[model samples]
Target: MADKEMRAVYAETLTELASKDDRIVVLEADLMRATGTGPFKEKYPDRAVNVGVAEANMLSIAGGMSTEGYIPFAATFGCFATRRAFDQFFLSCAYAGLNVKLVGTDPGVSAAFNGGTHMPFEDLGLVRMVPGIDIVEPSDPVSLKALVQQIAARPNSAYIRLHRKALSPLYPETATFEVGKAKVLRSGTGVTLAALGGLMVHNAVTAAELLAADGISAEVIDVLSLKPLDAETILASARKTGLVISIENHQAHNGLGSAVAELFAEAADRPARLVRMGIQDQFGEVGTEAWLLEKFGLRAEDIAAAVKKALKG
Candidate 1:
C-alpha cells in the first residue's frame, strides 16, 4: 500500500466535519501550519481561533467555548499540550466533563529533528492521570479520518496523539473503528504484540513477520485507543497466546505497556508474561525517525527480540 499524510487528512477531515456541524470549532496555538489546521482556519475563519503560541490560553479558551455548546478542537505540539497546559486542560475541560478535543501533533519520535524540548514521550501518561479523558492514536490515514470525526461527536473530553507526517496505510479506506477497541491485524498462537500510535503499530506488524520466519508465531494488535482500553480483546489474545509484548513510541510507564499490565493483573490467574518495549525513561533527542527508533531500541528487530525473550522466559 501507499503512504498518506495523516496531518493533511486530519485537516481535510476536520474541515468537512465543521461544514456539517456548526458546533465544531478549532483552536491552534499559532502553529497552524505545523499541526495541519491552516485549512480549517481558511475555510472557517469565524470558527478558527489562533492563540499565538499560548497553549494554556488556547486550552482555557477551548474549555470556555465547550461550555457554550461548541465542540472545540485545540491543536498544538504534544509537549505543550500535555505539559504546558496540563492544569487548564484537566481542571477546565476534563474535570468539568466538557466536550473539548485536544489534538497533540508529532508525538514522541514523530517530532523528528525538533530535538528534546519539542518531543513528548510522556503526554499519554500525563493525560491519563486526568479522570474520564479518552485517549487515541491513529495508526494510518483511514483511522485518523474516522476517529477525528468520531471523537468530536462524543460528549466528553478527548486527547489525540497525532503523527504529522505521512505513514504507511494499515487499513483499507472502508475500515471502520469504535473507541475503546483494539484491531487485531495478525493472529498467531505463540506471542501477542500490542502496539500503540504510528511507529510501534507498524513496527509490531513487521516484528510478527520476522517472528513467523523464525518459526515463532506472533499476534499483532493495533491499540489505537489507550484509555478505555479494549481489555476484553487483549485479555482474550493473551490467554490464547500466553505471552504479550507491548510496543509504544512513548515512555513504557503509564502507557501501552502499563495499560496491558493493569489488565492482566486485574484479570488474575492468567499465566501470561508481558514485556514492554519503549523509551526507557530517557528524553527524546534530535535525530531522524529511523535513528531514534534504533537509539531507543524500538525497531522491528527489537520487538521481535523482545517477543523471543518473552517466549523463552
Candidate 2:
C-alpha cells in the first residue's frame, strides 16, 4: 500500500476531473485548504469558487449552477453540510434532482481536536433520509478516489462524507470500489463483521486475529455505500455466519448498524444475532481522536468484544 490519505486522494481526483471537464465547478465554503482542495484551486483557479464560511448560501449557489448544466462539487465541514444547509440540500438539490456533489469533511470521530461541535455523528442518517440523494463514506484513499470518479461520471445529487485527517493505507491499490456494493474482504463461516468508513479495515484486521486465536473463523465485509446499501452481500454473509456485528464511527442508530439490521431482519429466514458497536446516544466532548474512540467503544478490542458477544449468543 502506498502512502495515501483520504483528503489527498480527493484533491488529486477533483483536480483530474477538472482537467477534463470544463463544466465541473468546485464551490468550497472557506475550506479549500482544510478539505484538500488547495491543489485543485491552484490548478483550476477559474473553475473553483471559494465562497467564504456561508454553507447555506454555497448550497443554494451550487444548486443553481447545477440546474444550469454545470456539475458542482460543494465542499465544507460535515456539521455545516447536514445541519446548517440541510434544507438547501433537501429542497434545492435533492428534491429537484440537481447534479450536485456535497462533500462533508471531518465526519464522526475524525473531527478530533475540533470537538463535538464539529463532529457529525448523524450526517449519514440525516442525508440518507433525503429523497433522491446518495450517501457515501469511502473507507480509504483508494476507495475515495474511485468514489470521486464514480460520482463525477454519474451526475446525481450525492453526499460524500470524508475524514478531517488521513487514515492509514489498508487496502490494495488494485482494490475495485463500486457504488451501492459491499466488498467481502475476508471469508468465514462462524461470524460476520460488517463495517463502514475507515473503521472497516480496523475491524477486519482485529476480527481476523481474534478468530485465529479462538479457532472460530469470521468473515469481514466493507459497506462502502451507506444508502442504497449492498443488501445482497449482507444477507449472504448473515445466512452463512448466523451471527453479525456492525462496526462504525457514527451512532448505533440510523447508520451502518441500523441499515444492516433492517436488511437482515427482512431477508434472512433465520436472522443472525446482531450487535451494533459505536457511539451510544450521546454527544462527544473535546478530546483526542484516540481517546474519543476508546471512550465510545470504537477500538479494535471493542469490535472484537462485540463479535465475541454475538458468538456467545
Candidate 3:
C-alpha cells in the first residue's frame, strides 16, 4: 500500500528546487492549502503568490513572470486549470514561447467528493491541442517529484496532470526517468496494458496479475508522458503482445487511448488490436474514488474482464 500524498511530494520538490534555483516561483489560484504547498509558502513567502481563485489571471501572471526568467509553476483544480485558464496558458505562455509549468491537481475521478463541476476528465486532451506544449502525468510520488524537476529544467511550456491524494509508491527513490519516455512495469507475451496517471497504471498492474492466474501474460506500461507518446516503447509492446489496451483516468477520446490508436494507425506495419478503456461519455458525479471506479467500469476487474473478452474474440 502507498502512504505518500502526491501534493506533499510536489510541494517538497518545488521547495527543494527553489533552494538551488532562485528563479523558481510557485503560483496558485487560492489553492495552496488544497494542493498542499503550505511548507513551500512558509519557507519562501516572496516566491509564492496566491491569485485568489482567479485561475486565468494566475496563468497570465505566470506567463508574464516567465518573461523575467522566473520558472513559474501555476496550479489549480484540473477543471479550471485547463478549461478556464487555457487561453492564457496557450497564448501568454506557450504561444509566446515562455517557460511555465502548469499543474492541474486531482485529475479525472480523483476529484471524488468534489463532484462533476470540479473534476477534469479532459484536461490532458485540452492541453494536447496546444502546439509545442508538453503533456505529462506522474504515476506516483517518485515520478511526480522527478517529472516536476524535469519539466522545470525544460524550455517548453508543459501541463502536468497530478493526482493530489495518496498513491502507493511504484518506483524506488533511485529510479530514473526521461521526460518523453514510457516505463515498462511488467513484461509479458499475451497482451499489453499501457496506462497513464497513478490510478490507471496501478489498476493495469493488478489486472496483469489477475491475467497471470488464467495463464495469460499481460505487459504493463506506465505512460508518463502524454504529448510525446513514447511511440517506440508502446509500439514495441504492441508488437510483442499483438493487443494493446490503453487505460486512463480521463475521457476515452484524445487521451491515452487516442494516443495509442494514433501510434498503431500510423505505424508502417501495425502489429496490434487496440481497446480504449475509460470514461466513455458522461460527466463525473459525486462519489468516492472506489465507487466512481466501479461506476465508470475502471476497476481492475473491469480491465481484466475487458482483456479476457478481447482475447476470446
Tell me the tens digit of each residue's lDDT in model 3 across 90-186: 9999999999999999999999999999889989889999999889999999999999999999998999998999999899989998889999999
RMSD of each: 1.0, 1.4, 1.0
Lowest lDDT 10-mer window, candidate 2? 199-208
Q: Which ten residues in a row have the lowest lDDT in candidate 3?
A: 1-10
Which candidate gets the maximum TM-score versus the true structure?
Answer: 3
Locate the minimum summed-lDDT window of 10 residues in model 1: 263-272
- Candidate 1 lDDT, tens digit per residue, 1-313? 3798888989999999998999999899989889778889888999999889899999889999999999999999999999999999998899988889999999998888998999999999999898998999999998898888889888999999999998989899889998888899999999999999988999999999999999998999999999889998898899899888889999999888898888888886874888888889999999998999999999999999887776677
List, residue by residue over 146-216, the lDDT tens digit for candidate 2: 88888888878999988646666667888878889888878888888888887555656676777769787
Model 3 has an lDDT value of: 0.93
Best by lDDT: 3
TM-score of each: 0.98, 0.96, 0.99
The lDDT of model 1 is: 0.90
Candidate order (TM-score) = 3, 1, 2
